[model samples]
Target: MTMYWRAISEDQPGPKWAGLFAEYWPAYLKWWLKEGDEVRASYRESQRMLKRHMPEMLPLYDQLCELAGGGDQAARFLSFYCPPPYLSGCSQALWPGKAPVLVRNYDYNPAAFDSLILRTGWMGRKVMGTSDGLWGLVDGMNDAGLAISLTFGGRRVVGEGFGVPLILRYVLQTCTTTEEAGQVLSRVPTHMSYNVTVVDRNRKYLTAMMAPDRATLITHAAVATNHQENVEWISHARFTATVERERYLLHRMSLHRDTEEKFISNFLKPPLYSTAFSYGFGTLYTAIYRPRKKQMEIRWPGTTWPLSLDSFEEGARQVNLPGAA
Candidate 1:
């Protein structure tokens, strides 16, 4: 399967951030409704569900509704189609408790990558109301050498709250450490289930935060596949169980002991459930952010496309001060 990959590093802060819904609401609504009025009705139901669950995010809700040209269209779409227990899949990993990573292979469609990216960036700018750009990060590494990755927990039951995608964006924009990130997660209620794996530069420490209805933090040598072990509670078993399967694969690949390159080689394979999940265009992408080295590498495993920070102004233009790493 083909994939689109990008890695960016900035010495100084970039432009103001934007909201993701600004660009996505219209296109997404139109696309989902193309099937007919029944589909449209279902979409409306979803939006209503979202509003009821996340009343605190009313400002964002209002912005999205306005962007979609008002009425309950945006609210309905979100309630019925977007939240957890409804939209059943995603995956992620984190590095050093700071760098956050994520991979989402939707059951919806495989060809939606290009449109998703364009619309995400557009909506990010518009909805976030930032001058910068729209981006729901697949993965992000922080200045502290803390990295994070995400994966969807395909469970039958999930707490009704804000979507994990938005939570992730909020974490990347605001938090700097595992503790800080965890606090953010604990405070915000999530609509769906997900596993967040965190890693540090030393690679000596790794943790996974599992959110079933609430958040639970766990300590392990490494976490693979779908299940996330946290302190407070263990999430119910997932229907897909990809994480369990991936755990075996990771063991065979020696991922816990291997170098980053080797680990990534086995980690980003095509999805096993091809019928339910598509593996084209956006299924797999990898990013390596080494804060200690003060550099980052973004790779498209399927396409073999690799890009380094040296190529961009955010990386090249800035002088690497001594001890910056």
Candidate 2:
């Protein structure tokens, strides 16, 4: 399944609207119920944390409830906090805001995948219903020269704190530089497991933060799969495979001593999926976000579709849309 979408806002202030919960509630509800009470409790805790860190998100939550048709189940699901676990195949290229792009090889179904792209805001809030259930992203960008991608890190004992989705949103909203983004992460309490990758305007800095019980900065040139540096924790069989695949890729890339551009290009190559050696359900799609050039591009490898990107800039762009702001 190869697909991508582009959203550009000249006067719209970074997508503060709420329509995703309404759009994918049925899928979300189905997955939420599967998790039972433990997941439900965690979601409630996530809601409380969201209210404290980003009160502005409350309206969106309320909107999601209304969209879910307003009932105890909807309320309960809305209150839950866990982000759907994703097997993301991503590559980043730097054009310094002008040419930043991200390519994503998403693992879920195509229909559900399209819904997520449409519902996500540039700088607002987004919730996606996936095979593993619901997940959130704060902001995502793709321009001429920069791109950013994030994925969850699941471990046994990361105590509850702010939901990873909110943190993703915060990064999209406030920071432009890797340094600035790192600073924001430093201040937050990341109680869950996550790996956030940032590719700046120049495409020179590619950094990952593996936040388990606490956030740890990773300086390695490349990271794949799940385990963080020096941390020992057993994960599910599927995740273990995913991590192993990443390690293999990282090692293979290291052998070449490639530049960032070459590294990303190599990483984006289509996976070979077979019953014996699966590439984790085949990557659904890939997207690139460029900051400096204020543009974004997306491609679908399976279908060989055209790459797409949307552009944006500072003072010239409106911070809020007509009624949504």
Q: Best candidate per lDDT, number?
A: 2
Give per-residue CA lDDT, model 2, range 114-173, as digits (tens).
323322333332211111123345235433233456554535555545555556555655
Query: Distance (Å) between predicted and true CA of 194, model 2?
Result: 1.8
Q: How do the residues 163-219 of candidate 1 rate in per-residue lDDT, one tens digit apiece?
A: 565555555455556666666666665656666555545553344454555555555
> Model 1 TM-score?
0.57
- Pick out the ten consecutive residues of candidate 2 with the lowest summed lDDT: 316-325
- What's the true lDDT of residue 99 in model 2? 42
Q: Name the regions of candidate 2 deviating beyond 4 angstroms.
A: 1-20, 37-39, 42-47, 59-104, 108-115, 119-135, 142-146, 152-154, 189-191, 202-206, 218-224, 231-265, 268-280, 302-325
User: Candidate 1: lDDT of 260?
Assistant: 48
lDDT of each: 0.42, 0.45
